[model samples]
Target: MKRRQTPSNGTMFLLLGFSDLSLAAQTSLFVFFLLSYLFAVIGNGLIMLVVTFSPRLNSPMYFFLTVLSFTEILSISSTAPKALQGFLKAGRTISLIGCATQFSVFIAAVNCESSILTVMAYDRYMAICQPLRYTSVMTVSVCWKLTMIAWIFAFGNAVIGFSVLFNLPFCESILIAHFFCDVLPVMSLACGNTFFLEVFQLIMSVTLIMSTFTLIICSYVRILTSIFLLPSAESRHKAFSTCGSHLVSVIIFFGSAMFVHFHLGNPLSPYNDRMVALSYCVIIPTINPLIYSLKNNEMKEAIWKLTLKIVALHM
Candidate 1:
């Protein structure tokens, strides 16, 4: 395929505006992102470890949770370290291929997470709405099949998106204004009319966001109706509590993603794009495991036990 070349003016010396910031602000941002990255890794890592070791957590829920943690780690790693390096260095120039690879992996991880969350919502629905049939419906074989499908779909989407994108001709100017090489930022650098790619991305974004979110909403609606019909307050509370963490995580992840990809204006400004990108790419992943672990008793207990074992070993 012939490469689409971007105009010369679009390509310029890209500087991560932070280099112009006061030393204090630079130091503050660096420290903030550094700590955020550390917590993200540790928090997600702990989730994976806990899910792996705890027999009580060997169900479909924790299985999906483990996959989520792994995806979160991959997603954050794609962008945060490079952004941190840019803050420390005088110049942050990512090679063309490197930028494309980063975006591809990041997109794949995000898509995988979306599908996994949808599957988890379905799991919750079965557990609550059809308690007796839950096991049969969400059998071990079914769970693995769903996970595999999610991964394959995500991989295909990422490959197609990146293949289309990398084929575009980039000018000599290689500076990406944002912390990462997101679709829009990279597209803006292309000289040709990226209308088709933009349209395709919008369609994909709407389909993924709306379809998954709709499934989740339907699941929760059924759950809520069932909860209300029950006479016992405790049962209702237990059911709602079980889903609350997942609900919040879904809102943050999908909300931020939809805002950035669907609602953001075309010819978006660098500042606006970067701010929105940070919410999905950096903020959500950092907070998700914390939210899940804190709200989930099983996960909390598993973490506690693991901590104790590690401490005992040290002693």
Candidate 2:
């Protein structure tokens, strides 16, 4: 493939992903990422399967877990394939429409993931603090509605943000200094005034992230209060254990995201930005299933039973 040295508006944008590194380094990263991407896909896929088919895991919590796993798969998949391709070849170009679509999907998936996490926290809150009302509140219909609302809001936000960004003229070079077409990098290439757009993006990002994170924090505070008030040590331990996986997941995801979005400085260099984004975008999703499964006894048992059933079928 020919390398594009110069790109402009209405043309393709060349992704310069880790091209500054040595060939050996790029190859190693390629291999590592390929394996990680596959593992993430398969791990999240397994989570969805177990949560869906295992009747033993029929609570609203598990239903939310299925939604999370699906969103994780979508989130990682948006960039992993293109990133892997970039590692193999130079001039990994994406058309304007293609880049816009990828960014849109990525934004939607990420926001959806945050929304689902917040909902999961609320689910836990209801189960622990309002156990008497949990069944009546978090019915199957309610769960489905919550999931739909998350997706709808996510895509709606993504469409609006990207539509404004893409409508701007681009007269500068179109070399994206990252693996994928991220908002900041793509915005850097636009010719017209982007201050308004940047402000708009910042507002939107903060609103989505901060709102969900605040709700999750509030839910956990109430949950922890209830757990502490429990009279029995065994019951308190059980309650804490139930929320352990989700707490860890929330920390890992939001920690990296906050660093990237709210750091006190100029924008991160391409290398640093890629490293930070790679953690939540790929690594977190890959290990999320393990976090939930290992922490939750019910999930572990369901997975074991499913594995046995699968092996028996093969035999």
Candidate 3:
């Protein structure tokens, strides 16, 4: 009898995206996701360019918003393209190395996004809770440093998370039940003991997710206290107007992420998992720009100006 080859680094993972459906259904799904991708890119791209060039948006809050827009683009781009390609391509395969790379990028984006959101909450907290010291507290250098730290921290986390799987052997059946590469899905393929890895991943997830959430919650608690202490109704209304968008965005991202991560390993609900993952990884990022823009006066004005500039150039 011939000795069977053990799957190693060269193994390929079939991304089994979207259930096997009719051609029409698949094509429709592709079109929907493609449009969503374009919308998110354009929305976030315009936000970045406007914030970079618009003098009116020179405040620390907008600076953080710009960081958020860019991060949103990066986060969604990591997973969406490959998932969209799954509809058109057969098997939708990626090499073990490629899968690992994708997971790292996706996870880094997620972590960076969470960090930025936390920082943004702090920005709002400062602006509202400490108006006199806002500029001094949120200096240009400080903002830049925070942004860099978030990026560095996220990437470092990804590196450490994947290091454990560096030499782990994969099973012969490499079919990933969901779209794109995710931490749990990728780790599930390993033939060796992954209990500690899963535990570590869960701990990290809870730590970051809950910690950031607690920070945001604490900031908001202070913010609400500060807002209510204001003598004038107009001031309280203004405070709400300023902070409402970020709060909505926070709920959206956190809600989706918590659902997906916590609800993993339900043997009876693969399709439910797929749907939730699709919405979380694809839909949420796309809608986030719209959420921020819809309520933001500054962003709306900037987008309008950018749109006119484009039309004028064409003419």
Could you say which candidate leads in TM-score?
2
Cα TM-score of candidate 2: 0.95
Q: lDDT for each of the candidates?
A: 0.83, 0.87, 0.83
Give the Å shift of residue 144 in candidate 3.
0.5
lDDT tens digits, residue span 141-218, model 3 = 999999999999999998987776545666666878878888777767777677877777777887889999999999
List the candidates ranked by lDDT, beginning with the highest: 2, 3, 1
TM-score per prediction, in order, is: 0.92, 0.95, 0.93
Off by over 4 Å in 3: 1-9, 265-268
For residues 1-315, write the lDDT of model 2, one tens digit per residue.
223233334578889988899989898888878988999899999999998889889989999999999999999999889998887665488898889888998999998999999999999999999999999999999999999999999999899978787877776577899998888988888775678787777777777779999999999999999999999999999999989999999999888878877852368878998888789778988999889987788988998999999999999
lDDT of 1: 0.83
Worst 10 residues of 3 by lDDT: 1-10
Q: Each candidate: RMSD to true structure? A: 3.3, 3.3, 2.3
The global Cα lDDT (0 to 1) of model 3 is 0.83
Q: Kindly give the stretch of ten consecutive residues in candidate 1 with the minimal lDDT sum.
A: 6-15
